[model samples]
Target: MPVIVVEVMPKPELLDPQGKAVAGALHRLGISDISGVRIGKRFEVTVDEVTDAVLAEVTKLADDMFSNSVIEDVVSISVHPAPASA
Candidate 1:
């Protein structure tokens, strides 16, 4: 099977409270090298095949269903082949 991966992230101009809290925790733990953090979403959908139509539909789903249009943007969509059996 093929897997379609969709990645979404909050718009750069917006604030991410979850990510901010994580950064604060990191700072408290003495991990000072990192300056910021932004949380995002990743969706993996197993599919029978990959085609133009399928890609188009997935893109629509990403925009309309998987993410909030007002605050998030669909950053990437990629297809990966299934892993080989051991």
Candidate 2:
């Protein structure tokens, strides 16, 4: 099986309270390298194989179910080969 990785995140213009809170805490802890943080969600969907048609379908699914087209954006959709069988 192949796995499809879907990532959804708030639009850059959208307010991310959780990410801001985490970033503030990190800054208070002296983690200064991080300037900003945006919270997001990831999903791993397993499929029988990776093909163009399958990818197209997955895109549709991502647009329909995985992401909120109004407030969030679909960050990425990538296919990974399943782990080798022992």
Instruction: Give each model a TM-score.
Output: 0.93, 0.89
- Record all residue pairs in model 1 with backbone atoms less than 3 Å apart, i.e. clashing: none
Report every candidate's CA lDDT. 0.94, 0.93
- Candidate 2 on 50-82: residue-level lDDT in tens? 999999999999999999899999999998998
lDDT of 1 by residue, 59-81 (tens): 99999999998999999999997
lDDT of 2 at 64: 97
Candidate 1 local Cα displacement, residue 72, angstroms: 0.3
Q: Pick the candidate with the highest TM-score.
A: 1
TM-score attained by model 2:
0.89
At residue 20, candidate 2 shows an lDDT of 97
